[model samples]
Target chain A: MSTASPVLDELLDALRCLPGVGARSAQRMAYHLLERDRQGGGRLATALQAAMQRIGNCVECRSFSESERCALCAGSTRERSQLCVVETPADLAAIEHATGYRGLYFVLLGRLSPLDGLGPEELGLPLLQRRLAQGEVRELILATNPTVEGEATAHYLAELAQTAGVRVSRLAHGVPLGGELEYIDRGTLAHAFGSRLPLN
Target chain B: MSTASPVLDELLDALRCLPGVGARSAQRMAYHLLERDRQGGGRLATALQAAMQRIGNCVECRSFSESERCALCAGSTRERSQLCVVETPADLAAIEHATGYRGLYFVLLGRLSPLDGLGPEELGLPLLQRRLAQGEVRELILATNPTVEGEATAHYLAELAQTAGVRVSRLAHGVPLGGELEYIDRGTLAHAFGSRLPLN
Candidate 1:
């Protein structure tokens, strides 16, 4: 997109660093900012700079924070006996929003993948072990995703919890609430069938 | 996404100013930058600020430029007798890349949409008139899009060119090359049928 403008070219290239943006979308975004929304573009730039410079991981849960501890970890009212562990801050947000659970959270930031060089230390398991050793938590809920890596991370965390004398639980894997059994996948149907709960 | 972080909230809100980003994409982008690509995010911030503050319209052609006149308009080798008028700089770039046209360009930055408060003055018709009055251009090529507003703008520009005693031409509109007749839309097929060209 050599519009005979070097600044425009630089902007287009910079916009492609986003996750799903490609060449065409980058061009569109650049043109949009230059033509119609310079103010918004400036605001976005300020926000991006501030976030990148100031936001850091919480000392306790390792979630993004501007201070030493995140707001969630700093709050006094939330139950500390039940710790829900998730892979990312987004997952923590989902659990916080959807469920009534008032327990604290531990964000892994990523799953354990040796191939990608993500090990126990990368997931902050040592910090988690120290937190479990404090005896403040009685239950460690494995709220990781249902993927293979998520399950493996959960297994590892379960052993850590057992060593710390804490109970462990996992999120249920079954057909969705409103989904028909006919439309459910075979694996989910099998898992639900195998783990069917008795009616009272 | 009340991640219990005000900075994160601000970042998400600012990200939504982009064209296609929404709630979910904003969250995903924020988390991605904080977790995976802080350096890229910082670079993007710098690029955005620099482009927004420094990039301005070329006085000669109304295209984006860092200086008073764009490189294309300032070049001495291009044909001065043929001036192409386009709705946007992106259109100018598309013509530059896809064809052998070596004429200078006048970018409107927008078409004449009266409902949106766009008129002759807004499209820089006064500046264009002064250019045409110089009498150096022998032909004016109307390369605006084929939309309704585009056609109206082209008609207005054609009259302007005629008043200056310059020959006027437009980009041909019809079925695209290699387009099968069976799959082509009705309007394009009908237009192609009506404007059948005579073979040399």
Candidate 2:
């Protein structure tokens, strides 16, 4: 028989919806919320409610936004001729943090997964094609993950962009910065070797 | 220059208030809430709000409760003569889950830490003494953690229970069940050895 209070059990189960949280972590989170930081928990609740209600997919890029278009899509100063496609908003955020990629972005939200019934349509490929057919964008950068499904999605998108007369490029595959040769994965090392650039 | 939207940032920051949640985990949680399960996120928010607002300390045992007294404290079926003292409601719940110990519980909520300004008063030792002075409890179980502060607090509480003419007992310290001796900590190994039991 479960000994947990009904409300506590409900809260614990609800917390499991978060990524990477397990039963123990959920329990700890529930306790912390109830015992120590009720005010903070209340603030979290308010924030979650407000964010969920207000945030929606940006019309143009499919990234999360409170308005119809995200700030990146709405900004006039971004390079309209270049478009960067990413699998998720988190990936878009990472690129935006690291590089001066002033180009507009298209967030696929997820890659094609036939087993899971996710398809080109699910990834908004038709919309991407329409954007490419507009003939304003000169270059398309594929910044999706380097996994097998990400590769398939990238290839599919590349075909679509090339058909629409837009040049397509993929992010470089290499040993990560500050990584040792022995520690790097074999696939990454092989890719880095294959994509080796000439000396300046 | 953060590219995160305002509401997204707020949600991320709010998630950090959870125990063991760092900036990256909070960001991941925020993204999960915003991207995948807005409905579940809404549920979590509602649960947090409701639990925080409704749950308070049980007047008798100091365990979390939605009403004036916790179910354990309110239940007449429990052994009122045996009071088990625990550091937190989580610890109390753990004990309840593992054992058929039908005794009432007193949750300290925290251990005594002089360096952190936590003391007997902070742990409601006076209230505990008053409860002990009522003279109905035959045994006072010291189930505070096995840390240094936990031991000190146990000693302090043991003295209080002895002064009130109640017997004091502590949770056994030993190598945990299913634990390998090689992997056990020295303190635990030493305690296990020191408290070795004779075979019947």
Candidate 3:
């Protein structure tokens, strides 16, 4: 028990605001900052400021980007005809990392949650419609998560895209790789049943 | 696996860099990033950057600060005669939270890990010596951790401070709260026995 400083307290409090980080973690992080060399802290600080200063939502796909368009959107060679709808830029990134996806992306930014008052507007669906109307996008892939809200959003977007004369498809659902069928839920089971496989 | 992205891979790699967060946790965190809102990730990025940008080490106490002098160093009203030497700024914070002490602090940032090549110069012992040379500090309290490295560092600091004509004191060796004295190691027991209190 001794003299305490308020500046350090403020820094610790700011660190506390990080996700999944508790008071103890925040304190540890603060100590790490204090204990680490100026070079490390200085580099971290510079990275933070640089990201804040440069990164923003892409104008085209709403993905995080250093400019108005993200790297994917900025690239001219990638297919612009087929559009994959996802919940966030991270989802788009996830698909990109997995490879073989050659279509453009329409980042919805969020899913439909009527209870939470989040609707098509909150997800920027109007922009999606406008993009579809521009005649470049022919197919719309509903790549939302398999959760209830995600399913609902996918269904809604599929119907909307159908009316726009854009062929719609959903991500395939079944037992995940390295995952047992027993752990699969009833909804997935029902979908698997509807899309039954041929006997060997 | 229908939808995969390289961004997810990068994000996964980034997640692994965080302390105590490993591959499985990194996967969980990445899944969370895909599922959760910008509120969490955005805030983390901002906080990480802000802390790096604004926070720095205190010139006097060697704790993290956002200004030229930390709050403790800046405060003129606190006790300046006694000094509490700690392994890290978080230790100072923990002691401060427990309340009562009003002496100044001197953070070591790290303990003496000879195998890891950490030494007095790495811990800013010269600065501490200069401070003690001024003769304002009469009592030097060693509040280092109870680990072997911590004990060694405390002893080394104690010797140095004592050599500079200051009264050196080490923190008491005691059974931790909720820990059984019987379960404690033999070395700790011996130390606790040597520093035992009188029978009431």
Candidate 4:
């Protein structure tokens, strides 16, 4: 026998669509929405609907945007000669927030995962190729994550960029800033050692 | 420079109202909603609005319901002689799900927190007193959590029930089912030892 009302049960099930939100968390969220912040929940619903309706993939970079092109891609001052390719718009946002990279971006939206049937076409690689072929791009930076699929996607993109007569670069892999050596994984340590930069 | 659209940012901020949902999780949820399940997000929004509009406290139990009284309180088969007092509707639902407790319930919505200014009045103790005075309730079961505040609230309610000439009982506390003895806290272990029942 279900312990919650039908609407509450449907709300709980709907809340589980959020990443990392399991049954317990969904229940807590449902109860909170129902018992305390019904107004806030209503606002959230409106916001969700508005956002889903307004936001779409940027035509130029494929990142989420309210218009045909994202603000970053439409900016005239950003360097057109440098393009940073990331697996998701979230990664692009992280780099924009934390780094001084004043270049254009191309969000693949996902890595090439053969097991999941996600390939170049699925990631909109043809669009990326078209952008590179414009000859304005001098460098293509692979900013996909450090996972196996990310690495494979970056390698494939590098080959594509090289064939298009553009220089290719990968984000450096290293022990993170303020990371302890003892806690650093062996794979990262090895990559850091292998890719050690020279002091100029 | 904000990488997300204004609507997306609003949605992310709105999502943070959920308990334990931080900025990162909010971003992830927003992305998931936009990238994967726009329809599901819309459904959630509709459910949130509908639930907020329809669901309110049951007049008798104070638990969330669509009508004046909840289904449980409206049921004729339930034992009117036994009243179960719980801290929240979630707790009431838990008891209903885990056991064959057919008694009526009163939801406190919160425990007494003097520091937070949540006292007896905030938990609607007068309403509880009136219910106890109805003369139909013979036993009042305290199903509040085993926390300090929960215990204090339970004690306070027990005194009130005593004044009304109603018998009060507390739920048993022990090492949880499948919990290891070594991992159990000292307070729980002591309580378990003191309340040890005969194996007859």
The C-alpha RMSD in Å for every predicted model, in order, reads 1.5, 1.8, 5.2, 2.2
User: lDDT at A100 for candidate 3?
Assistant: 86
Residue B136's lDDT in candidate 3? 96
Q: How many backbone clashes does candidate 1 have?
A: 0
DockQ of candidate 4 relative to the true structure: 0.66
- lDDT per residue as tens, model 1, B1-200: 56688888899999998999999999988999889899999999999999999999999889889999889889898998999999997788788989999989999989999999999999999999999999998999999999999999999999999998899999999999999999999998999999999999
lDDT of 4 by residue, A134-187 (tens): 999999999999999999999999999999999999998899999999999999
| Residue-by-residue lDDT tens digits, candidate 3, B1-200 | 21233444455555444466676565555455434533445555556556656776778888777777787778887799989998887788888788688888998888999788888988889999999999999999999998889989988998998799999998777666687888998887787788789999
Write model 2 residue lDDT over B122-183, tens digit each, in one string: 88888899999998899999999999999999999999998999999999999999999999
Note the DockQ of each predicted structure. Answer: 0.79, 0.70, 0.23, 0.66
Best candidate, lDDT: 1
Please state what fraction of the native interface contacts candidate 4 reproduces: 0.73
Instruction: Give the distance in Å from residue B156's predicted Cα in candidate 4 to where it truly belongs.
Output: 2.5
Q: Is model 2 an incorrect, acceptable, medium or high docking prediction?
A: medium
Off by over 4 Å in 2: none
Candidate number with the higher TM-score (2 or 4): 2
| lDDT (tens digit, per residue) of candidate 4 on B91-193 | 9878888998888999998999999999989898989999999899999999999999999999999999999999999998998999999999999999999
Each candidate structure's TM-score, on Cα atoms with residue i matched to residue i, is 0.96, 0.95, 0.75, 0.92
DockQ of 3: 0.23
Q: Model 4 segments beyond 4 Å from truth?
A: B198-200
* Candidate 3 global Cα RMSD: 5.2
Q: Which ten residues in a row have the lowest lDDT in candidate 2 chain B?
A: B1-10
- What would the TM-score be for candidate 4 when compared with the true structure? 0.92
Q: What is the interface RMSD of candidate 4, in Å?
A: 1.7
Model 1: DockQ score: 0.79
lDDT of 2: 0.90
Candidate order by TM-score, decreasing, is 1, 2, 4, 3
